[model samples]
Target: MSWEEMLTTVQESLITYWDGLVGSLPKLGAALFLIFLTWGAVTLARAFIRKLGSKTRMRKNLTDVLSMLAGTGLWLMGTLIALAIVFPSITPGKALTTLGLGSVAIGFAFKDTFENFLAGILILLREPFAIGDHVECDDIEGQIEEITIRDTHVRQTDGQLVVVPNHLLFQNPVTVRTNRDLRRTTIICGVAYGENVDDARSVIEAAVREVDSVRNDVKDVQVFAQEFAASSINFEVTWWTGSQPLDIRTSRDQVVAAVKRALDDAGIEIPFPYRTLTFNEPIPVREQGAQDEAA
Candidate 1:
């Protein structure tokens, strides 16, 4: 086609498209307004959810999830309404069908993300552990700082923060250290074989009871001669103390010191490892004077 003819056709097409856009301006405006309206509605709904969550005894993580879900639903509804207003041909059912078909691909692409999300939801619902609770899972031993949709934040003993995937926590065995008010701790104390077992056991039990943190009212202290070691007799000392890690450490330290002092004062020996040498054959020796004379 000639250049002028091509130019004329392009001009006509632009004018037609422009006229169509102008004719649909009202619907476009409505769609934009609906989006804003949806935002406001979702904001109000989230606020209401937060208030409701506060009134109940639900966990903060669960409350956050509920509010997020409500917002998501409201936004989704608004998006469908806007789409329908703009196109006048789209329906919610059709939109859902399209999403269903696309979701397969999306799920495959983000498999781990979806797994963590689901695991987080289950964890929140089951209440296995909560924020500020001390837990040990796999190699992570720390207090739970926060629980989110993708990961859990743990503050380790040394103040290092660890981000753990929710799925790993759900699948693995988690030890909730602070689940109760008291936890049992054991210390192995060894005395010289010559010391009286009964005497040593009494001394250890008494020393453990003297510790401030040890629970004496419960009468949970136990000291038994567990086994004979290479150099000493071992006493398995067990007691009940506070459940926190710091509490356990402090109680153990106090018990060890108290036991050592008590044993020393009573003249009961806490022996060190001893070794004796044996000669398979006799060795010949010459006096220094005799060797000098021979030389």
Candidate 2:
């Protein structure tokens, strides 16, 4: 084609497209207004949901998930409505068909993301553990700080923060330490072999009971001679205490100190490892002068 003919064709196409855009301006404006309206509605709904959650006994994580799902659903509906207004032929069915066709590629590209998202949803629904619960999952043990759509945030005992993927938590065994009000803790105390077993047991039981954090209501404090060790007899002392990790640690510390002092006061020996060596055969003794002559 000649240059003048090509220029004329391009000019005609531009004019036609400009006229079409001008005709659709009102629909475009309505679509934008609808989207903004949906956004405002979503915000209000979220606030209302949060307010309702606070009034009820529902978990914070569940409330957050519910709010997110509600907002996403509303946005999706608004987007479809806007699209249909802009292009009357594009219906929800058609949009879904288009998504279905492209879903395989999208799924492959974002497999882990979707997996975590689904897992997070399941976890929130199950209510296995909540924020501030002390949980040990796989190799991670910490207090749950936050639960998100993709990951969970944990604050470890050492003050380190860990972001754990939700899929791992869902798949693995999780130990929720704070699920109950009380937890049982045990300590092994060894008394010298010469000490009276009954007396040592009594002393340990008393000492553990004296600890302020130890739960005394249940009569769960127990002391039993477990086994004979290499150096001393071991007493297995079990007691109930608060379920928190700090509670267990503090109670244990107090129990240990109290037991040590009580035993020392009672003159009940807590012995160190004692060993004696004996030769199987007698050896001849040689004087220093005799060794020098032999050399």
Backbone collisions counted per model: 0, 0
Model 2: weakest 10-residue lDDT segment is 211-220
Clashing pairs in 2: none
Per-residue alpha-carbon lDDT of candidate 1 for residues 66-134, written as tens digits (9 for 90 to 100): 888889999999999999998877988899899999999999999999999999989988899999899
List per-prediction Cα lDDT, in the order shown.
Answer: 0.93, 0.93
Task: Compute the lDDT of residue 163 as modeled in candidate 1.
Answer: 99
- The digit string of per-residue lDDT tens for model 2 on 1-295 reads 9999999999999999999999999999999999999999999999999999999977888989999999999998999999999999999889978988899899999999999999999999898998889999888999999998899999999999999999999999999999998999999999998889989888888888888888988756988899999999998889999899999999999999999999999999999999978999998898999999999
Q: Candidate 2 — which residues are off by over 4 angstroms?
A: 1-37, 57-61, 282-295
Model 1 earns a TM-score of 0.81
In Å, residue 275's CA in model 1 sits off its true spot by 2.9
